[model samples]
Target chain A: MSEFLIASLAICGTFAIYHIALWVHRTWNHSLTAPVLVATTLVIVVLITFRIPYETYMVGGKWINELLGPAVVALAYPLYRYKDTLKKVAAPIVAGTLLGGIIGISTGLLLAQWAGFEATIVYSLTPKSVTTPVAMAVTESIGGVMPLAAIFVMIAGIGGVLMHHYVFRLFQVDHYLGRGVGMGSASHAIGTATSMEVNQLEGAVSTISMVMSALVVSIIAPSLVQLMM
Target chain B: MEKVGKMIMHIGLLYIIFQFGNWIQRTLHLFIPGSVIGMIVLFLLLSTKLVRVSWIEEGANYIVANLAFFFIPVTVGIIEYYDLFLGKGSLLILIVLVSTMLVMGGSGFFSQWLMRRKEWKHE
Candidate 1:
């Protein structure tokens, strides 16, 4: 088959699979069946079984991936929707996210170094707390493996979303401010989505926290790596 | 026709801002990502009332709603490292998972404490 045909197939096939996965998520309504998790796994399984290479899949996949940047830019909209609360309660939000972003980076850096992974892997782990698109760009700027950074962000986001309830309960995080910052800083987009599902205030605040974490990490991750290295 | 036009205009404007951000980052040799800068620029525009929410709300909502879908193409590359991951991947995953929990607890506790402190002050 021609590359164009193959690429078109890959693109169309992905959209179909992702929609089906989204259906499964709606039906099951569980974190384990989350759309990103299920769709990614399903696609990987199909590719491995079909003997299609990752590069070929990406011929068209890159077009979809390129939208990630604009999607990130779109985050500003939701954040802006909560501008009043942001101005009214900016102190806790900023403080909480600053601590979370720095602490998350520090602990991940130390853990990765202690694990004795390569330097590239360590760098990738530095920006893993932010959303994938922002994390990917930060990974490149900091001389890390970009893909690995994305994987780390996904893992952190999913894991944080899954564990957030227990974490909040145990920490006595009864307020929306606490819940929002926690999920947003640690989990990024996925966690923010989950928070939004549960509470509108939490969701709105999570959006701010997520954006702030991205901005904070992009600025400090490189320096933190340098200091620790 | 108007809705379609507004949607197209929204995307085009966003892309231009994103590119403009990239240009600034490139010329000034800044480390921050252009997309992030664009996001801030948009937020500032909205806050300043230079851009109305009605104008760009739809496209922004669609993109943010399905943010995960956009990254699947690149993230699927994790499969290529199947061998390496299969070897000791579980351990790496565990470390990140645990740290994620720690982050949640730490941030939640800190923010909650601050909020409570503020409440106490008011009382």
Candidate 2:
């Protein structure tokens, strides 16, 4: 079979497995997003390990990733629809975002350093809380590896999913708006997805946070890297 | 004739807003992108009651909701680097998995804590 066809089959097959898992675990009410993303990527990675080229995976996965832009554009509708509430929280949103951005980058760098990660890895880790495109660009500008940035982005997403609830509880962040913004800013898309489950207000704030975080990190990270170096 | 002129003016305003956003980013050395600055501008205008959100809602929504589509070209670039990912595939996988969990958990916790602090201040 053609490589594209094989990759398509692989992606589809992986999704099938993910859905089946969700079905089996439906009674438990667990999330299927993380599992699906991790499983699909894992399956593809395993295939690559056996000499199935990444080009083949890209042939299929490319289509999936391509949808990221339009999905982002779609966020405008909700933002507009909820402008009233958004307006009320505008100051806090921006403030929270700036603080979150600073804390996220600083904490990651410190922890990575404390763990004895190499300098290159430490630079790559700085943008983990940001979205992929911004993080990738920041990574490249600072001489960090692009693929490593991608890995970091994915890790950030998974982390957002697994620990958001516990964190929310621990911090006593009961307000839906604050919770959503925190999640979206910190975890990007994955956190936004989790926010959606909480409430529409949370979802909207999360979307805002995600987009803002991307823009903030992209512009800020490069300069921060230069200064730190 | 006047209404048509007004409509033209509104379009011009949006163009200026976008440019202004870009200019601010370039001039002020802000860490955020121009488009985002433009977004903040728009948000501010709406909040101050200077401009109605309805005026830009349609366009803004279109961009935000479908933001994911823009990443396609970038991801397609992944095909070019297939070899690199393959060469260190396992290590990459491990890093991605571990770091993602850490970022998600850490950030979530930190933000939540900040939120609580904010709440406490209010009380």
Among the numbered candidates, top lDDT falls to 1
Interface C-alpha RMSD after superposing true interface residues, each candidate, one decimal: 2.6, 6.1
TM-scores for every candidate against the unseen true structure? 0.84, 0.63
Cα deviation of A196, candidate 1, in Å: 5.2
Tell me how candidate 2 scores on lDDT. 0.60
Which candidate achieves the best DockQ against the true structure? Answer: 1
For model 1, residues B34-82, the per-residue Cα lDDT tens digits are 7777888889989899988887898887666666676567557778766
Which regions of candidate 2 deviate over 4 angstroms? A7-11, A14-26, A31-55, A222-229, B1-123
Q: Predicted candidate 1: interface RMSD? A: 2.6
| List of chain B TM-scores, one per candidate | 0.81, 0.64
Q: What's candidate 2's DockQ score?
A: 0.14
The Cα local distance difference test for each model comes to: 0.81, 0.60
- RMSD to the true structure for each prediction, in A, is 3.3, 8.0
Q: Could you tell me which 10 consecutive residues in candidate 1 chain A have the lowest summed lDDT? A: A192-201
The sequence of per-residue lDDT tens digits that candidate 1 reaches over residues A14-107 is 8888789779978998756766677788889999999999998998898787666676677788778877866777888889999998989899
- CAPRI quality band, candidate 1: medium
lDDT tens readout by residue for model 2, A58-88: 6766655544433443344466568887876
